[model samples]
Target: MLSPNSVYTSKKLGHYIVTILTIIAGSTVVATQINLGNRYRGFTITQLISSYNIFCSIILTSQFVCSVLELWSRFRTLNGQLLESLSCVGRPGLSQLLLGWRKRGNGEDLAARLRRLQHVHLVLQRAAELLQAHVSPAVTFHLMYSVVGIIYGSYELLVVSQAQNRAESMIISPSTSYSLCWLVHHLFDLVALTVSCSILEDEEMQASVLLRRAVGIEETVPQVEAFLRQIKRGPAICFTASGLLPIDRRLLVSAVSAATTYLIVLGQFGLR
Candidate 1:
């Protein structure tokens, strides 16, 4: 469905360019930090994790973006094919006017269209399986790094802010600026990931709705019911992080709540 046409070409090109630029930026930042002895020169554990927080955030964000793109590409194709298949419903008028009514064996034409729909459904199911399998591990890594980054980064920022409040004059260091940017990057990364999974869920819901329509059309075809029944029996394509966390807006809300709670607890205990 997404062939090398203008719409597809332009969209793909833009995403690729952005991804490349992000990769270069992340790599350059890490290299600079190491060369400037910001972390690599007999770094303490805190400094090491601090460095890792940025590096992992970048890596995981890129992986999530790529995975989301791939999944979206497949689902878009599925949606297009689904529309084509739906045309077989002969909802009257448009399809008949375009191709003209078949004067020959009408049953054969209907059967062929039904078969095409079945084939497309099979392809969609296969794609959904592959997408889930490929992205699950990456999602798990993203979630893990996200939790660590949020908690640790928030602690660092809170302590620094408090110190600055007590100081007569605030002096900003390169590391401090980098840390601030790092925290912002984590926020962006989390939002990006949350949106990506939400889109996947939406696509799956679209497919389900299409199948339900097919079930409705079963009144006429009677045969499409078999195919629809098969699909309906299986679980819908649900994206989860390492089979534990469901990727949804609820996950995003809960993660924020949990992070905030922990940060407060850490502050109370005088995390140093």
Candidate 2:
């Protein structure tokens, strides 16, 4: 009786719901396992929590190293492409320079000046394009890895809470565990953002140096200084707005406070 499109839509919605439920069920099992492990092994919940973080840190570090290597490879590839493009325009060879100019300054032949200017412009434009392209994937990879690390950290936090049987220790509704998960997730994200921003800023400065060289400019310290200034200012403004501001700061703060409070309470009551 239903239209084909409607039937397809319903099926898709059903699959999505099923997927979500399955994830929830899987998480519940993991939490239960953590709780059982703590009980049977006679491990203090705090010890279990510490172990979880240690494990998560090891995993994140390995992934971070792999991501850095990948980023470096991409950066090298981008540099190679830019260099190849510059080579196509031909470098200022010794023979070309040996052809002495017949005139000086503004009196120089218009055609020659125009050619030099065109080459400069093309080099600058290509450098700009390459810089833009290089930044996009680096930012994307950082964000993707940060997000995954955040999720893993969140799961560890949730397991820690469950192991302690202090589910209500989270400030937000414990019924919506995902919200608490995200709060912890964002904390890890803040650290990742800072590290990634530093790496990107360094790469931008290097790219600027390469660009200046391509345009036949002497790569002076002042020019490098200016590039570093731009890198320091630009990405922070963009990344703060893009990454940090969107997170619920108040919720995160409250969750952290709650976590501390839970630790104190355990020390007083549970540990005693």
Candidate 3:
């Protein structure tokens, strides 16, 4: 049984983790961009444009992360509440059993509780829908950005590594360093996004398992029957990017595979 306090503590921890990671990523990108700019003389137009581009990208990425984190926190709270409700439904107090006017009265009490939990489940679904609606566009754009960035950045690194001998490549290229940093940053962001969604999906599964157990309790009610039906017939309890791309470990896997394939093709073209 998950306590509300524990859920709140976990949410605070997640906030700290996200904040620290965002700082590190943003700093690394800024540092690399500065290093690259130092190579050019007189703070030229090209350098100005490059700096502006990096700034904008960092800002947008940070905004997307913040949005996702907020939604993730809400989902965690609702998940915890659902679990708590389901657990209580499974176990009733001994006092309630002894003092009830009759078994029928006790059964009615349990049915009412189940009905309330059913309401909670409905609210949870609504929260999920709200989250999806608000973040789907941003998520879709982020996914596309990550795919393109990884493919191009990987290609650039490969070209640099190939063009220079080991010693020269190891010691001489700011561009190589920048590309490597950018790739790491993008990959980290993508992994974080996918992991967050995966965790929420796992929570949904946990709730379903608890609900199934609740079905076997001695005082089964129509609410329980309808609850099971709702679980089956309701919209899939999973996250998606614009209802087009499912955001999960599988998305991460497919993104990496596609990037690798494109990188290989680009390498072949460069060789030719």
Candidate 4:
């Protein structure tokens, strides 16, 4: 009993799921080859896998830090605007005190308070933006990384196969790896999307209440829906621009393809 919109959304979600699975499968194949080659050259599978994870972690962490700084800068700008707005209004209910404080009191103290508020506001704003930008995508990335790790870890199977001179019996086919990786990625993305959507709905409800109070108009469902759509702008921009840029996608695919081919070749060689 799904509506047309619901059906379309489900189809779209399925497509993303397939894409992520392909990425995982490709990564696994590459990783397996890399690990096997290292092993053949006298490195243990554990050593190769550990080094790979360490490298990936460093890259991911650097990206995360840069994202945080960009978000922080945006928040600071927003907060400066809020403080400037407040300063223009100037000590709203205490006209006499304002004159006295502006002259006799340390102007520095008032400036400091304003600055502190600005900083606090900026930090809060940045945290909110970070949550909006990262929550779902981070979950998706983590899930994808986990699949990569698990499949890569399972190269121990290949190692054993090589050791026993039975590498052909334990080949990790691309399709098999891709299927498992895709399943994991899709499930994780679904969970992340559901949680993010729920939070967005709650935010929309709050915004509707505020709008109703300020404008003295009852908020209609359509109005609330429109507001919710507006809120999605940030996530949409982040995904399109920051999360899945063409360069990043190309690099990831290239790496996965290279790795998978290498592993297949190694498996064949080891069997001989």
Steric collisions counted per model? 0, 0, 0, 5
Q: Which ten residues in a row have the lowest lDDT in candidate 3?
A: 95-104
- Alpha-carbon lDDT of model 1: 0.61
The lDDT of model 3 is 0.63
| lDDT against true structure, model 2 | 0.41
lDDT of 1 at 173: 28
lDDT of 4 by residue, 6-37 (tens): 34544454455445545544564455455455
Q: Tell me the tens digit of each residue's lDDT in model 3 across 159-259.
A: 77675544233332336667777777678667777876786667556555555655665345566677677777777567788878788899999989998
TM-scores of the candidates are: 0.69, 0.30, 0.73, 0.28
Candidate number with greatest lDDT: 3
Query: Which residue pairs collide, candidate 3?
Result: none
Sliding window of 10 residues with minimal summed lDDT for model 1: 166-175
Better of 3 and 4 by TM-score: 3
**Using TM-score as the measure, which candidate wins?**
3
TM-score of 1: 0.69
lDDT of 3 at 265: 88
Which residue pairs collide, candidate 4?
Answer: 21-182, 29-260, 30-259, 30-260, 33-263
lDDT for 70 in candidate 3 is 51
Error of 3 at 132 (Å): 1.8
Give the poorly placed runs of model 4, Cα more than 4 Å off: 1-42, 94-139, 143-272
